[model samples]
Target: MAWQLEGTYFENCNCNMICPCSTSGLTEPATRDRCNVMLAFHVDRGDVNGVDVSGLNVAVVADTPALMSDGGWRMGLLMDSAASQEQADALGAVFGGKLGGPMEGLGPLVGEMLGMESRAITYANDGREHSVQIDDAINVKVEDFVSPLDATGAGVKVSGVGFPADTLAAGHATASTVNIFGLSWDNTGKNSFSAPFAWSA
Candidate 1:
């Protein structure tokens, strides 16, 4: 089966202004003892084995060791409540790394699977800001870092990093909170990144 997905992705993590994990390729220890993060995606266009999955939202919540590459992570997946069973299952296969794609790179790091759930997910990207609300489980919003020297107000970005996207816009979380899977955090004012992503297999 062939699958393709294109989306806007963003994440908020319990790290300083610029997360070392992003630049260090997950080799450096996080600013904190643990890395608590929420990855949210809004699929603008997608298909898996002939099933359309456009306009759907998905999220991954993770708690990893300070040095992510050491590979001990507890993670859970959240699928949009609006999805049909077939759609959800298809997405699960792709995101769970069952089907070869970018996410497969992450499969080796997960030590525990907190299981998947269907929840109401709201994702918004209004150019300068990105926000996501997953039912009562998570709430977060990030604003891009705009350089005063640049008149166009584009976000300060970094490229050639080991991430899902080729380039990532640096940002900070204005409001962040999470309570799910026995993990809780208030990462307000922490590190954040946003980018457009495309994955196929």
Candidate 2:
């Protein structure tokens, strides 16, 4: 039951420029620190249990506290409405990390099932701008990079990480407080990335 998916997302977190997680650092955010990332998946061509998932979309809403290993976070999944019951179930299984895909490794850290919904996704990346909004669930914006002399939208890059491997990432993030699986977070600060990523089941 191994499938492949390619997509992008806009993540919001409470950290300084260049989130420590992206560089393999286990540093914690401020006292009220949190990490809430929204992953929007567009299954270019994938399936589960004989289900067709070519044009389907799914999302992963993850929240981590402080050090990200405290393991008291929550998750919520969103599936496209066009999918049939069987297809929806299959999509849920895969995105929920139950089918042993690239995201399965995070399963052990999941706190609870916040439930899944059917919604639309708006994802885009233009040169230095990256953004994605789930209709009304979440809205994230990536600011452009600043110049060294001017110190506008200063940008930085980190090697070896998830998707968008050689990321052209900026040093800023803007997001609103959100409630997913009963957890609330206004992930602000230096936690945003757009890099290349590749993982197998």
Best by lDDT: 1
Q: Which stretches in model 1 have alpha-carbon errors above 4 Å? A: none
Per-candidate local distance difference test: 0.92, 0.62
Clash list (residue pairs), candidate 1: none
Give, for candidate 2, the lowest lDDT window spanning 10 residues: 23-32
Worst 10 residues of 1 by lDDT: 155-164
Tens digit per residue, CA lDDT, model 1, 47-155 = 9989999999999999999999998899999999999999999999888999989889899999999999999999999877999998888999999899889898776
For all predictions, the C-alpha RMSD in Å is: 1.0, 3.7
lDDT of 2 by residue, 1-201 (tens): 565555444455555666676555334453345676655555556657667776666667776776666677678888877678888888888777788865576677778778888776666666566666667666666664556776554456666554334453645665544555565666555566664333345
- What's the lDDT for residue 153 in model 1? 79
Error of 1 at 110 (Å): 0.4
Model 1 residue 105 lDDT?
88
